[model samples]
Target: MVSYAAENQLVHLLYARGYAVMRAPRSGRVGLPTPDLVAIRGKKVLVIECKSRKTGFTVEREQLEQLKEWKRRTGGAAYIAWKRTRLGLFLKLADVIKNKGNVGKKFAEEYGIKIKNEE
Candidate 1:
């Protein structure tokens, strides 16, 4: 399916986990680094940049930077959800990925949270 579909599904999963979520306005037209998803559960807040890549997931420097700025400004968390294979893997915005490299289970263990079982 398309990346937008992945984003929508991710939104639902976040809601199920008790985070109030909203899909940001389309970024290309908005001309801003708005994250794909914004979620808050009680005192916790997150800005998520979602990706659905066939190859390893890679985050744009600008995207990650903006997410970092958001977290810095809000004193909350920022994450990148690499929805590569329904694993629902996530990484901290500060985490490094060298040139399109995929995150390993260690990153998953540290930052990832499964939203759905493998399908």
Candidate 2:
């Protein structure tokens, strides 16, 4: 499970930038998975799944597929925020994870998204 504090910190960063953000509820009894954060600014919508790199970037297949489906259906960009890094990494999930165990650095680097936070 992703840490609430990490997700909260990421959401706070977006909120500081005047972006509207909401935390998606966990999928337990609901049986439906949702992105970790839903951020909106103007016409930009970010379906972000927040994770802490301290434990490595990990995402569920169902969540990833749902995010992709959301993009296809809603036209919003989906990203996996790899938190707790040197400057944090916002990886735009290109597609569903193939025959892999985890979403590794090489795969994330392919997105070419390097968001530097103002320290």
For all candidates in order, the CA lDDT equals 0.71, 0.72
Candidate 1: residue pairs that collide: none
lDDT of each residue in 54-107, candidate 1, tens digit only: 554445666667887888876888877877664677676666443233455565
Candidate 1: stretches off by over 4 Å:
25-29, 97-113, 117-119
* C-alpha lDDT of candidate 1 relative to the true structure: 0.71
Best by TM-score: 2
lDDT assessment of candidate 2: 0.72
What C-alpha lDDT, on a 0 to 100 scale, does residue 113 get in candidate 1?
62
Error of 2 at 106 (Å): 4.0
lDDT of 2 at 29: 26
User: How do all models score by TM-score?
Assistant: 0.76, 0.77
User: Highest lDDT, which number?
Assistant: 2
Residue 21, model 1, lDDT: 97
List, residue by residue over 6-105, the lDDT tens digit for candidate 2.
7888888888888899887675326665777889898888898777766455577777888887777658898877765554677777742552326666
